[model samples]
Each structure stands twice: as structure tokens, then as C-alpha cells.
Target chain A: MTHPKRVQLLVGSPRGKRSTSTAVGSYVLNLLKQKGLEPLASLWIGHILKSPEKIDEFLKAVEAADMIILAAPLYDDCQPYIVIKAMELLAAHQREQSTTQKRHDGKLFSVIVNCAFPEEHHPETVLRIYRRFAKDMGFLWGGSLAIRAGEALQGRQGKTLDDIGSMAKKVKEALVRMADSLSKGSPSADETLSVIPESFSHGPLSFLGSFFIWLNNRGWAKQAKKRGEDVNARPYME
Target chain B: MKALILNGSLEHQTHLAAIQEILEDELSKAGWECESLILHRLKVGTCIGCFKCWDTTPGICFQDDQGREINKKAIHSNLLVFLTPLTWGGYSSELKKAIERMLGLLHPDFIKIKDSYRHRKRYDHYPSVLGIAVGREKKDSEEEEIFKTLIKRHSLNWHTPKQKAEVFLDKDDDEKIRESIKKIVVEMGVRK
Candidate 1:
């Protein structure tokens, strides 16, 4: 496959521009921009989905692009509702195009999925769904990268990968690598992304999971305490 | 006994509708007070990732919507049923909105289960889950596997006593759907 001249980033967070999903996706987008690509566009699905005109415009942008990079969070073990809804619309559009004897063959589809959990394994199912979408829709599979402990990045909102320093070192490197491949119009090998050398997983630091859970529990406890509510309250049973 | 059937179909398909009817009829025959909800028609809003449900009021979403009522019924029911068309090996966006809102049902704390960390359940007795996903065709086995795994992962995290995930195709007939519902009710602790 040849390199794509036009690449579009689809941000699937409900928070739109302020979301970490956008930050991560935009990081890669900036890398691609520096690689001498055309001016990039990042379409936040959350803002445009409810309006018919905006959604059509989003679809047109997608159709016009040679590649689509979907950056979304893992919700309920898979993708959020907005992402799925967007996919449903895109799938329908692709089907319509197919019926009309039109094809956007060789369009590359890639995924950057992040999860709150501190385990790389959690986002596996969502990544599989994305690969299936590409395969079924006839796009070349551009591979996927799943970020673990994405909640940790919430504190570093609005900061670029380089600005975050060590905490985001691996992620920044991964995105750069991914951008490098995309810039050459080459689909990332499925095997290359899976071997990220424990990127964002806190490799060999097993205590991070329990630490995150403890810290999460404490934060919620503090919030509940301020409102005079019990974190463990069984409201439904009573 | 009570059963809450959450129908998450975006479009009304005869096959999925037949499956819903079969499940409701079986639950009713078994002396269950069954309520089936068509999620697409509900005025439920998407979860904005605010932890208000857990941080402010434990076990209840602050958002004034049908999701709170659905979660209440789900907590009280003996069986919580999910009915949906599996999109890209997952539930439709409509059904997922309701599911995300139910996060209030789990506390922010996590407990290790089978070496994986999951949210702790907020209530004493959690209901059994039965997920039935309709696929576009029978040959879509890979997507079906992913969908079933997604349900099982949910069951593990929800700490359900019993759980089952079934995938049906558009060509699947009424009798086959009925048989599957019978198996779930009889074996998965709903018909007790």
C-alpha cells in the first residue's frame, strides 16, 4: 500500500476537545504534521453526532481521507456509546457506497485505545472489535495500541507528551513509531504494536495495580465524605 | 421473582423481536414479573464520565433519566437480561448508554478476581445476567466470540452468581430462540 496523502483523526471521547483521547490522538497528528503531511483535521465525534448536518460533514471528511485513526477510551469493557454510534453510521455509509458501486479500497484504519485499568489485557477486546471493523469494511488493518492506566493522565490534562516527561515517555515513543509507519504509507504490522515492551503497563512493577486501586478508593471516599455520604452505602437495598 | 429485560436494538428486527417475546413469555410462565425495556426509545443520556454516582451519592446516578430507574429494576430483579444487536462484537450504542449509567451500581473500589482487578459491588445480592446478542449472519463466528467474551468479562466484574451469553442470527427461527430462552431460565437460576 502507498502512503496516505490525507489522514484524519476521529476522537471518540464525549468530552470532545478536552479529553485525553484527543490529546493522545493529537500527539500523533502533530507528529504526522511534522513529517511533511498536509494540514491535519481531528473530528470529535461527541460534538457532531447529534446533528444531521455535522454528522454528514464528518462522514464526508472520512470518505475524503485515505486513512482514519480512531482514538477512543475503553468503557464497559469495550468502546463508549458515542464511538459505537459513530461506527454504526460509518458502517452504514460504507454499505451504501458499496451498493452504489463505489469503493474506498486501501483506506487504512488504526486504533489507539486507552483504559482506566492498569492492565494492558483489559483493552484487548475493544482492539479486536476495531480490527474486525476494518476487515469487514475492506480497509487495510493499520494495527492498534492500547494504553493502560489512562486515568493517571487525567492529572496532566492539556499537556503534550513531551511536557509530561517520564510518565508519558513510552506512549510518546509509541505514537512516534506509529506516525513514522503511517507517514511512509505503510500499514503497521499487527505483530509490531503488540510488542510494545510493556508501554504504559508499569512493567515489572506489579504493585501499581493495588496502588491505583487504593488511590482510587481513597479519592472516592474523600469525595463522598465531603457530601456526608458513605462510599459503601447500599442505597438500593434499603 | 422479577426479571428486567433490556432490549438494546437500534432498529426493530423481526428476529430480535421474536427472541424478546420468547424470553418474556418464558419468564412469565415461570412466575416471573418481567419488564422488557426498549432502550432506543428511552430518553437516556450518555455518561459524561463524571464520578458523581459514586463520589456524591453512592449507588445512584445524579442524572435524572430512565437509566436510574433501569438500574433500580436491575438491582431488584432476580435476572438481568441484555438484548441487543452485537455491533463490532459489542452491544449497540443505545444499550451501552444504559450500561455505562449502571456504573453507579459498583463502587470505585476494586477487588482482585482471578488475578484481575474489578470494581467492588455496591449491593448485597447481585442479579444473574443473561446477554443475548443478534448477529447479522450465522457465519460471523469471530464477532460472536468477541461478544460472548465481552459479556463474560462483565459477568466476572459484576460478580454475578450465574451468567450466559448467546448469539443469534437474523435467519434464526422462533423455535430455536425459544429453546435458548428455556435453557437460560432453567439452568441460569431464573426459573427457580
Candidate 2:
């Protein structure tokens, strides 16, 4: 007669349902439901009040969940202000949990940052920010996904229907993989780091690679200008 | 020069007080007129992202609460200092709420300049920001973590001089930290 444990979802996009986070959040929730797991989706957009009552409500949901997924759009290269508030609330809630001798069992955590820039260009700065939060809040981060602008949204006719379908399928697959890891309660500490390649990566080699790309981009700009072509002739490569 | 000091730390904690005391003295030494807002003592709410400011209103949010009131002062100041405690590798909940609420000033719908224009059609002034995050002795490293977490690429790209300062109060060198705060204050004091 026991029901499956719950997974609470915090989607931080002021854009609401139209946000890429919503798309990914829905995919994750549906994936969990298919596995007979209850997914509670909480949309945290505008007006993140800090009243005790509001904090208590959010804490109750977070504590009840087996895992927490923080989905947000990258703003100013970081999460929206509400996401920061949510993390603050969670940290404080943990202190309360400690007094009651109840350790939070919420295991897996991940971030999905919908950035306007192509995922390849500069997702690192945002990823670094998210990973640091994940560590500070004591969450076992699975990974992250960065959905570039104009790739999947409405009225972006460049990507074919098949491309969109593939993207959705890949996203669904990633969510399922993450869920399976979460259910085991033995999540790895590898910190998959969600580098889309298409996104940025960690370590020294990536830094060197980035520097080279910067050099190349600068060279391209110089050559264009010398040719009397507009350096702004084309938007900077994603 | 006028400086607006905002202590966004919840409960007006000692660490923020240390920063304020040191900053005020340094700023006074440098001859800057300082106006500080100890944020936690005031009432401020999170941004609702209503977009009313951009679409319906030109430069004001519908909510004329403390956040907007503070924004008015911020506009008048030449420098803005945000002193906050690092809570879970980021700013305090109260601080984040205050920053987000300031979004009303950046509403594109409120003032639109066409791409062809080289200058702003209507200018909204934003003061230089100095973000200082202090962590407890047991969590000094966490302060840097939060600093990295909060400073985004786009923020760095902004032409304004927005700098970040951090101190692990538990293991901090008071003199060096004071000097750093002083440098910022002195610059603010001398700026136009």
C-alpha cells in the first residue's frame, strides 16, 4: 500500500510555462511518473516572498521530496534572484531539520539553464555558479542542460521537426538516466558537470581551449575589419 | 560624491557592521558623502516581473515599496555598496530579493531605443556596485564560492565599474580588508 516517494521540482523562470525550463521540467516530471514516481512541480517565478509562512510551505514540499530539480533560465550569467532565495531557504531549512534529528534524504540535484547564447560559447560561468550552489547546499548534483535560444522555441524555423523531436527525446532520455541514478540512493560524486561541448567543460585543458577560441575569434574579427568587411557583419559565433 | 551603502545581511549581522564601520570611516577619510541603507531593517519584497514598468510605466514599478524607495536613493548615489552574508554560496535571501526587485529599472519595454540609435533615448542611471560577501570563520572558502556563483559573465561585460570583494571574517586580516574597503570608498569619494 506504500506509494512511491516524491520528487519536488522548482522551476525558476519568470517566463512561466513558455520558459525552456518548463519544457524540460515537464519532460522530467512525465519521465518520473512513467516510473511510478510522484513528481511535484512548483513554479517559482516572480514575487519570491520571504515570509515564514511561505518559507514553511516550500520547506514542507522540499523535505517531503526524495530529490529536487532546480530548473532556471540563466540571468546575468547566473540564476534568477528567486533561485538564490530558494537555496537560502533550503539551507536554513536544513538547520531546522538538524535540530529535529532529521536528515534530508533528498538525494539527486541538477540544473537546466536556458541561455540565449549558444550552449558552446560560455555555459561554464553559469555551470560553475550552479555547481558551487549544489555543493554548498549539500545536494548530489547529477548534471545540467543548456538549451540555446532560437534552437527549440516557437517561430524558430531553422531547426527541422525531426531535430526538435530528437532534442526532446534526448532530453527525456537524460532525465530518465538521472532518475534511475536517484532511485538507487547511491549517486556518484563524479560531478558530470553538464558541459554541452556545445557547452563549456572543466579542467586546465578546457581553459586552454577557451583561450585558443578567444584568440581565433579575435583573429577572425581583425581579418574581417582589414578586409573592409563589417566585424559586426555577422553576429559573433555562438 | 554621494555613496549609498546597503547592508542586505539579515539581522544586521556583525560582519556587515564591520564592513560598514570600516567603509564609512574610510569613505569619510576620502571625503565622500555617504548614505547607507541597512536593507534588512527595511521592508523589501522579491520582484514579481510584472513588466508593467517597461510597458505601462516608464521608470517605476507598481510596487512603491521599500525596494523602489531605495532604488530612488540608489539613482542619486555615485556608488552603491551591497554588504551581505554568504548563505549557501550566495547572498542572503533578503539581499537577493532586493537585487531582483531592482529589475524594474532595466525594463526594456519602459524605454526602448532603436538599434539605429547610438545613445539611449531615455537614460536611467545605475551607480557603480561593490558587492562584498563575508562568510563565517568555518566557511571562508564558501564566500569565494558564492562570489564565483553570483558574478556572471554578462555582469563583467557591463561598462560600469562593478567590483566584488570578499572576506572570510573567521580568518580575515582586518587591516587588509579595511584597506580594500577604503580603496573603494576613496574612489567613490573622488568620482564625479
Candidate 3:
């Protein structure tokens, strides 16, 4: 079979194109661009929810693409509702005609997930869920990349992976590695998994814990203060 | 005791509806008041990822929809029962909307639990969780394991004192389904 080349990125953050998911996903797609693959412009799940035309347009694009990359933030323990909605709709759109249970027609499915927790493993469940999605839809699993976006990016939204400077260096390398493998062929499950184990758990490296905590706490406090709201208000405790 | 069952059946498949019925009837007989929400019927808006609930106006969502109300109800309840069709081994989109908006119910600060660090609950007490993922076939696939693991993860992340997950196959008879749910209730320590 010819090498799967067409790449369509679906950013699942409600913040749309200005999200860290877009940043990370776009960086990879741009890298794939340097190769021979022609990646289509990203389609944001949150943007086309209400527009039937846009939704149809993207689903049509999915049919034409060789690979689908879902870049989403881990909300709670799973993908955001918008992304889940996209999954539901995509299932209906893609498999409407398939009579078989699993349609492995040489398509590929990969995911890029971001989480707020200091530990990168927090997105594990979401990643597994997406992998399950790949199986259910009969897409070749292209592995996943999970990052501590809120802190590593220092709560930076609307910033590209390149624009985030050194903080994004390691993640960028992993993305480049995955892109290289994808541009070659759909990775055989193990090839795309380049997890960054940046955790603040109590251990020999626990000294770095406070730094992340301080950055996150300061960012939330400053944002809350700017809006003049109590960051720690326990409304339910009353 | 009060139980909140978030019904996530997308099509109300006959077996699933029966399971929900048996769940409500059995839980009521077990000496608990049940508030079951048919999520698709409610006007729950999507969480806009606005950290306003966390940063700007803590413990509050600005949507003014059923999503906010569900969060309030969940935090106040003694038990949370996640009922879904195991979409990709996770809650359906209908059920996930409420769960996503529930971010405010968890404090953004990480609290170490066992091996990993997870966000702590904002309230003094958090309700234990029970997840029921339904499937049409009885095959034991990766989806079932993924669903179970996600629930167990939630038990830790959401700080649930007790939790259980069961996969209900469409081929399952009413008695088998009831037994599975009863096992969850017993495991959850909520069976009065």
C-alpha cells in the first residue's frame, strides 16, 4: 500500500485555535509539512458544533485523510465533551456504510493529550480511551503524546510550541520523532509513545515540586485576583 | 443515603433501559433516595474550559445551565453512579459534559494519593463513585478493561472513598444485571 500521507488534525480544546492542543498538534503537522505529506488545516471540534455545514465538511475531510490526529486537553479524567461529541459524530459519519465491525482500511488514528496535573501520567486514561477509539473505529493506532501543558507552558494559551521557548524543547523533540516516524509510515503502536515523566511526587527529585506548585498557584491566584474572585472559596463547605 | 445516577444511554436500548429501571428500583429498595438524570434530555451546556470555575469564580460555572446544577448536585450527593454505554471505554459524551464541568468540584492543587498526585476535593466530603458501562455483546475486549481502569482512576482522582465498575452486556439477563449492580452497591458500601 502506498504510504499514508494526508494528515488531518482535530484540536479538541474549547479555546479553539488558541489552545495548547493546537500549538502542539500544529507543530507536528508543520513538521510533517517539511516532509512530503500535505496536512490539511486543523478542524476545531468546539468551533463547528453548531454548524452542520462545517461538521459535514470536516467529516468529509476525515474520509479523504490517511491519518487523523486528535489533540485535546484532558478535562477531568477524559477528553472534553466537545471531543467526545466529535467522536460520536465521527463514528456515525465514518462507519455509516460499513457492514463489518472493524474496518481496517489502512487509515490511522493518533492522539496528543495535555493535562494540568504536574505528572504526565494523568492523561493516561484519556490516551487509553483514544486508543480504544482507534480499535473501535479500525484505525491503525499511532500511539500518543501526553504533556503537563498548564505548567510546562506556564499556563500559556495562544502560544505555539515553538513560541513557548525552552520549556517546550523536550516535548518538541518527542513530537519531531513521532512526526518522522509517521511521515515514514503509521507507527506500529510502540513507535509514537515518547512519554515525558515530569512529576513532582515526593522523592529524590521532590525539590522541583515546590517550583511547579508555586508557578501554578501564582498563576491561578493572579488570574483570580485580576477578576476579583476568591480562588479558594469553598462555596459548598458552608 | 442519596444516589445520583447519570444515565448515559444514547438510544435507550431495551436492555439498558431495563437495567436503569432495575437499578432505580433496586437502589430504592436498598433504602436510598435516587435522583436519576437522563442527561440527553437536559440542557447541559458544554464547559467552555474557562478556568473561571477554578480561578475567577471558584466552585462555580457561568453557564447557568443544567451542567452547573449537576455539579452542585454531585458535590452534595452521597453517591455518584456513572451510567453509560461505554463509548470508547469511557462515559458517553452526554455523561462526560457533567463530569467535565465538575472540575471546579476538585481543587486545582495536587494532592498525593498512593503512587501519584491528583487534585483534591473542594468539599469536605466527596461522594463515592460507581460506573456502569453497557455493551451489546459479552465479549471481553480492551474497552471493558479501559472502562474499569478509568473508573478506578476516578476513585482516586475524585477522592472517592468507595467505587466499583461493572460491564453489563445486552445478552445479560435481568438477574445477572441485578447481581452485578448489587455487587457494586455492596462494594461501594452504600447498600443500606
Candidate 4:
């Protein structure tokens, strides 16, 4: 039997030491290793992205990888600058160079955003920012894992959220399926990725309304209230 | 309204041009003079998160990064507009790091508080935000929902001017997106 192709996972975490992002990256790396496919994982910190050269180095790594999984923590409800910046540079480079040469056609792109609170709902709106980034760069999105912030490192050291167990089996199963797809060159199994759907829609009003409901249902409404907004009277889409 | 437009696209990728044209046209029609800072052409760095501006340094972050200059412009402007592209569901890292390093606006003086959380006088009041997230979405066309949520969340952070509007351009249709921009511009009072 042929050995599966090598996979490169780029981990984007603003948190330097002892982070939930690293924990998830470790888990994915281990699972891939257990499957006997060579997986290379590296961490990219946001603060270190000082110049275009640094961003270019990251794009090079992403180009070499068969699949890229972004393991990041939700900062201020979105991916930190390092991850976003890295993706932007990569996409730009691909677009600029596509006419001259074939850009990296890395089959899959995935994100595991570890947030402080994990709901049984969809990923945050901020994650949609990355979805747009991935789509522009022409990566076949492999889906995302919005694990409860704390659960990733429950057995280890550092902060862990309460709902890790709530989505463990489901998350693991999803990751396994994603890994298989990466090995086989197929679309990810999680077809209901919330971000991409909103990106390509013509119905802006309907999309805006649904997103407003989704945001309110999550802790965003409370945050808005904390900042002194009557969420009920003023609907988001309005 | 004197508006400044910052395009963050790299060389040859014309997406930034599209956004600039739409935004500039709307703002100019409203009689606003607009300027742009295309960040990809600028020299900048991420915020180190060192609290030097709060204690060690007065009215300055130790690092002489581009954030200080941008912050100055933001402070001077009536309506600070950021024409940033979405990266991983957030602002570009350059913009993000630049945003974090804006703590130079905070005063050097600080006071200890009672309960637990120490409070420093917030130096810079955030400007009214009108974020436009362009690109693809999941679930066929679900990215609009995500952009809408992003806009709402971002708006919550600001002391908004009673009313605001947002445009989510996930799909790459210039004409349709142009129409959306027109609508949002009217809501923002930039177009009569």
C-alpha cells in the first residue's frame, strides 16, 4: 500500500505559553501521527509578524503543506493578527503569482478556534473573517473546530473550560474524518460550515438577519448589554 | 466629511481597488474628501503588549512602530475609517497589531481601584466603525451571516452615533456589491 502524503499544519496562536490552541494542535498532530502519515506542526505567534518577509516565510510553509490546519484561540471574537496577516499575505502572493506559475493547491484548510466559552451552536462571526480569507486564497476549506476554551488541556496544565467533554467525541470524530479526507484528496465531511455559506450569498438581508440571531444567541448580546445596548429593542440587522 | 481610505492589498491583486472605488464614490458623492493608506505598502509591526506606555513611557509606546503614526491620524480625523480585508474572520495582522499597539493614547498616570480590576482612564475613544468584510463563505453562501455578526460585535465596542450601517460582500460581484455599498453609505449619512 502507498503511504499517505505528508501534511503540514500551521498553528496560529497569540498566546505564547500554555495555550488551549497548542493543546488542540497537539491532539491533531498526534492523531495524524497515529495514522502513520507524516504531519509537521509549527506555531505562529501574532506579535512576531513584524514585516512582509516574516509573513512570506509562513506562506512558504503553507505552500509546502498538503493540508493546513489553523489552530488558534479566539481573540476579541476573531483570529489574532498573526493568523489573519499570514493568510492575507499568502492569498495575495498566490493571486499575484498564479498567472506566472501554479499556486499551491493545498487541498484542505481547517481551523480550530478555542474560545473561553463553547456553545452548542456555530462558530463565532469572527471566524467568518478567516473563512473569507481562505476562500480568497483558494483553499478547499476542511471545516473548523470551536472547542470550549478550557477543554483541550483538561488533563494537562493551565486554563480549561467546562464543556470539553460536551463536544469531545464529536470533535474527535470530525477531525478523524478531516484527516482521512486530507489523505484521500476529498472535501471535508462537515458540509455545514457556517462561515462559507454567508460569504457567497446574494440575499444580504436574510443573511444579516440570521447572523444577528446567531450573534445574540451567543454571549455577544450579553457583551453588548454590558456595553449598554438594549439588544431587544434594536435588532442587529435593522 | 473628509474620509481616508486604506487599501491593504498586495501588488497586482485588484480587490482593494474595487473597495476603494465603491467607498470613495459614495463618500465623494456625500461631499467628503477621502484619502487612503494601503497598508501592504507600509512598514509596520505587531504590538508587543508591553505596558510601557502606561507606566515607563508617557504618551508613547517604547517601540517606534507605525501604530503611533496611524493613531495620530485617527485622533485627528472626525470619522476614522479602516478599509481592512478580513483574514481568518478578523482584521489583517498588520491592522490587528497596529490596533493593539494604539495603547500609546493611554495616559502614563494610573490609579489603583477598590474591587479588584484596576482601571486606567481610557485615553482614546474608539471611532465609529464601518467594517466591510469581502470574500467567500461556507454552507454555500453563509458568510454573510458571519460578516453581519462581525459588524454587530464591532459596533458594540464603539460609542456609536445613534445609527450605523454595514455591508457584507462575501460574493465577488462588483455591481451587486456596489449597490450594497450605496445602501450602507446612505445609512451612514454619506449619501443624500
Reproduced native contacts, each prediction: 0.82, 0.20, 0.76, 0.27
Q: Model 3, A87-157: lDDT tens per residue?
A: 99888776676576335556878787777665656677888888777877778887777776354663335
If ranked by lDDT, best first, what sequence of candidates would result?
1, 3, 2, 4
TM-score comparison, 3 vs 4, better candidate: 3
Q: What is the C-alpha local distance difference test score of each model?
A: 0.81, 0.58, 0.78, 0.55
Q: 2 or 3: which has the higher TM-score?
A: 3
Q: After aligning candidate 4 to the native by TM-score, how far in Å is the CA of B40 from where it should be?
A: 4.6
Docking class of 2: incorrect
Question: What is the per-residue lDDT of model 1 for residues B1-192, given as tens digits with 9 covering 90 to 100?
Answer: 888999998865445678888898999999999999998889898887767888888888888888888988999988899888878888888889899999989988977766666898788778889999998776588988998898888788788888899898877888887887788788887776
Q: Which ten residues in a row have the lowest lDDT in candidate 1 chain A?
A: A191-200
Once fitted onto the true fold, the runs of candidate 2 whose alpha carbons sit more than 4 angstroms away are A1-5, A14-20, A41-54, A116-126, A150-238, B107-125, B145-149, B152-154, B162-164, B170-176, B184-192
Candidate 1 local distance difference test against the native:
0.81
Per-residue lDDT of candidate 2, residues B47-148 (tens digit)? 654544444444556676888878677666767777778655556666766766655444231111221101121234456767677777664564475575
DockQ of 1: 0.79
Q: For residues A1-238, could you state the per-residue lDDT of candidate 2 as single tens digits?
A: 2233677778787655555666666666666677777777565544344466776778777767777777777655566777776776677667666564445433567666666443344455566666666675566675666655322332123332234664455445555676565555434232222212432323445554355345544653465456554333211111
Q: Which number leads on lDDT? A: 1
- Each candidate's B-chain TM-score, in sequence, is 0.94, 0.78, 0.93, 0.73
Two-chain DockQ for each candidate model: 0.79, 0.15, 0.70, 0.17
The B-chain TM-score of model 4 reads 0.73
Tell me which of candidates 2 and 4 scores higher on TM-score.
2
Q: Candidate 3 at B21: error in angstroms?
A: 1.5
